[model samples]
Target: MMDFDVELIRRYAAENKIKFGRASSKAVIGKVIASMPEYKTRVRELIPVIERVVEEINSMSIEDLKRYYSPPVKKKVKEEFRLPPLPKAVEGMVSTRFAPNPDFVLHLGSLRPLILSYEYAKMYNGKFYIRFEDTDPKTKRPEPRFYEAIKRDVEWLGIKPDKYIYQSDRLELYYDVARTLIDRGYAYVCLCERDVFKKYVYNGLACPHRGQSIEDNHELFDKMLNRFFNEGEAVLRIKTDLNHPNPSVRDWPALRIIDTETYRHPRVYDEYIVWPLYNFSCAIDDYMMGITHVLRGAEHRVNEVKQSYIFRYMGWDPPEYIHHGRVAIPEGVLSKSKILKGIREGLYTGIDDPRLATLPALRRRGFHPKALYNVILKTGLSSSNTTIDFSMLAAENRKVIDREANRYYGVRNPKTVYIYLMDDVEVKIRVHPDHPERGYRIFRLYRGENYIYIDFEDEKYLEYGDLIMLISLGNFRVGEETLEFINNDV
Candidate 1:
């Protein structure tokens, strides 16, 4: 067996644990083999020695590892939340996707998934994707501009997706999957009335049409694709246990007919009538795109549970899920319908309205992407819902822009003040108080009468003989109608 320093291995493992939160034996062993020149010639015999070192590292307690790896001088560290550990299986091959409906622009709450997926993908040196879930062309009609707008929004956040996909372009793939499910007796066509079906679903009972033969279901499904059935006349639902606790999982509807003529799709107008719902299309895409991990809102937990039935019937392993809490802004609206209505009603501007919490609006308001990232990183992945007041966002944003934003003075409802100067004064004020290298604004007041403006409202607080400092200039005395200079001590 090749010999190695036991103490060195312990120290290295401790440091690795500090960095990765878990001591990886493979990494530790590889590091040892690379560092020791003797192992180059005896690589085959080093396994036993490496295994012994691995056991030693694994035996170290969390407290011992932290104490061993900590810096000598204690300092207060930032108490920021971090993403929980990723599954070991997704280490190098991690792939994540952000699916956005192109009906509207992305909001602050939408950034949670985009940031998490992109960050996690980057953390593992993996791939990130931007998939437009614009399959619903009727109820959630997608605008042509929003596709590009959403892309620009993600790019503005400094996240460039490795791939871009549109569900409309992949209709045939979804159709084939749906057909396969129907043929395998795992899905059926439900022609029952919409309201009646809902009533049946609520009671954890299957509709009468759920017992349709696979052959009949396949024929009806083709008719659905062929546009023979009108909207709401029929729907395709996946097979699940009738007595399942969650009524949503009891043979949930997968595909439904939509009248594309009225609410036409921008990409593929009137091309298809049968469109997949959120769960089915999303689950299929997640599997088809090789997504290893899914980071979405806790509101999608029901979707996850419902989609698991599809994955099980299709014999595909579902991706690991990380559901975070909802982020609400009390001062800003989150509803897309309400925002759009407000825009139409002339209550606000477009998507970049300052009152809105959209990514574009925040960008226009001088908020940096790093500040948003910091806020999201601190929030981490928790199922507990959170309400983010505007002040909280302002405080976070202030930290990012305060260092660079230039300073200026302004007076509202201004009135002129004449200063009778006894001497010339040169005033130099740094553009940014924290950064002098950015230069200053200079004001040269010559000996004579000089005029400056102050708010008209300030006259109420002033008295005739009172002395006042004209900030950056000098002190002056308030006269009966005009101001007189006292000294240039300012």
Candidate 2:
């Protein structure tokens, strides 16, 4: 391992016209001594390290040598990003929506899809909406409070959706689409047991009930809606290619009999028993709500396939699908199940635990909304996965908040040092270093006090007889016990 930066040697080799290592170590040392000021003191220690780097550079490829010499010229793109015009976008007619389950509060990672959808809508002077995917009331249930909490967070981020929808409230609409799908022979009610269905499906074969008459399936479906079928007793399956390579996609389930008595929904408690599944409710809503483009994570790519079948069965066109990669953070808890577990187990205070990356936590910690907005704009629509380093967010926050935040002097440990002065000292300190026109605060040091507090950490920089320059006040020397007033030099 080299003690010094390897780039230094490569750059030095390239700059000196000595790519083949014909130059001697002494020559490199002499050149460093001439160019660098501190080499005069550390020349003895850095000699051998520099010599080793020179030897290593001798065998580097010609292309690598040139790479160090001349880096690729980056195209001068405009810093203000006008994101590439979305495909199939219509002026004043584009529409986008962010469909999130109202289980957990919105977290930092949720900002991507929200920002993309909202910004794309605003870009075309179109409509943006938020659809609450609250259909899975038993497994991934929604809370009455979260429906409003989600809206509050979005509004806090300056996103005003054109509409807000709850899937549970639209059960009747989903039932209508299911009926249409059944009439077209694109869906069927399956009564086979879980294991029996898996056996038939895994073998690329249909169960006995898959070929039931359309009229018969309708009767069974009505029974399910009327609470006739118990949980797992029957499910509506959208008929797809049973021989398809993806086993999960083979005649996937659309709606199931959810026993609301056992696990009640917060919004529609025991109101609807047979509820639509994710793909079913989402597909129905997308086409019905006039969604022009669907911007979501790439993991939902298979859901598009299931939803497309429903749209086709109804003779409707599916919305444009844009699936980007997932966004992750180090040790972040984005899973609602894990977060809910933590809260129930008393490990976390709530969804707004300052330790977590929830929107409320970041807001309480004073992170500006534009900081999160800039982060999303920087990431854009890359298909590759994103792992955010929070320091980048902090840097962005500093940029957003630094201009308006007033300056203040804070010290951990204050050390009182005796000061001998004949008169009081008054100084005007700027409230903000960048904006002097804002105002100034008057600081007065009384002479009768005979002492001033210095930061404990700054004491290490003092010597027996060193002078400390107090800006706009004067210079004073550090005495054995007292601070010697040097001069009234501002």
Candidate 3:
């Protein structure tokens, strides 16, 4: 042990470049004295406790010897944690917009898609905007009350958009896009009447305007536009691939002039006669808003391809697309337009009628937002059409409401009961049996009381001198029965 301690101290001193004052032979004798069992035990156990004192005495300067013996202590500075970088395409984050035409109140079909789009945007941590696509003046009813009601219903369902956009504010932009397409020879003004246009358009057949140059077509377009504005005439059609298999693909109308007083720009009606179609407007808006993902109902699946063609023609990258299934109503439920007619004709109340699947009606019937979310989640994010049982939704609602709703007892029909208890005896009845923590309600019982209220059904089963139990109170004996009351005198 003595020899081992001396060797350890000598090695540490050498490694640390510490110079002992004594020569090697004298140092060995001094080390022998210092490494005795008693001395070794004292130093080994106590040195760690006095390390700071030893460091101070030694004045440990490693600057000169660092390279030779002592290595520098590498200081570890604390660093702030950072998340991994996002893709460049989404670094600024993508934006999604839910554009609902405010021509009528939003029904279950609309709400289903809105919820889906909103949730999908949130999942990707993107911004969501709500745009009122009130472009068609003919369809746009001049009613602020309907708009206010729709907004209120959306808010009640907890879906508030980060930004609100209106198509009516961007009519000029749509016109500009239409003009660009016409100048680029991708669109031409059609002289054909509505029926002729529909036959060629719906059948995917080529129109006579397909081979005409914009210079040649513009003259005819101007004549049509002038007559349409001043005399009321024809429309402009987009020149797409006529050979495309989908009937919706052939020479589709990009613009049309509608003579309606409902146009917000009635004064500018003469300045621009042509109006952009739904697909054109959608393509322009999506590109301008920098939307990366377009989530919509499957009914618009074919429209997605049409919009993609428009984007391709304009040299813009179309947004990523996902089309979900539409919510179908049962046969008896009227179409939205018919429902509006019914409301106007006093067939039903306003849009939130309980029989309808509007958000307000579901809320009024005590359905929780969680239950609605659950229904959507259970439905899954697929394009397959599914009809969910209404009773299934109702059962889910009852589970949530049952825990929080207060209980009360009311008899539909009643008869009088007379009770005779000892004078000043008290009876206590609890409002809820399983919930005793809610406390109890008291009833006073007086001796020879003439009459009290009981259910009429309770009287038919009771006989003379029969003891009947009150739900939460002691039993009483029935003494007699009259037309008005059951007399108990026990």
Q: Show model 3 residue runs off by greater than 4 Å.
A: 1-94, 140-142, 199-205, 216-232, 262-273, 331-334, 360-370, 419-490
Please give, for residues 1-490, the per-residue lDDT of candidate 3 as tens digits.
Answer: 3224534443343333234211132233334434453554465543442333223323434343333344337564533222222223363376677887766666556656677667666766887888777666655533555567678877877886888777666877876777677789888877676677678777767667677887876776666555444323556777777778786677777677765443544324434445567888888999998877776788897788778767977899888776777666563253677777878999869776777776666676667776676576566556788665455576557655555555676765787666655555565655555566777777765554545676665456566655444544444556665222133221
Per-model TM-score, in order, reads: 0.76, 0.82, 0.67
Residue-level lDDT of model 2, residues 1-490, one tens digit each, is: 3344556655675544332223346566765655564556776777887777666665555456677677447564434656778889999999999998887789988999999999999999999999999998888878878888999999999999998888888999988888988898988999999999999999999999989999999999999999888999999999999998888899999999888999898888998998888888888889989999999999999998878888877888889999888898885677777877899999889888766788987887788998889888888888899977566687779877877788877656898878776688888878897789989988887774376677675565567776565566667788887877777765
> Order the candidates by lDDT, highest first — what do you get?
1, 2, 3
Alpha carbon lDDT of each predicted model: 0.82, 0.81, 0.62
Model 2, position 435, has a per-residue lDDT of 88
Q: Is candidate 2 or candidate 3 better by lDDT?
A: 2
Query: lDDT per residue, candidate 1, 65-155, as tens digits?
Result: 7655665574646545567777754667999999999998998898788998888898888999999999998888889899989988888
What 10-residue stretch in candidate 1 is worst by lDDT?
Answer: 17-26
For this target, which candidate reaches the highest lDDT against the unseen true structure? 1
- CA RMSD, predictions in order: 19.0, 10.2, 28.0
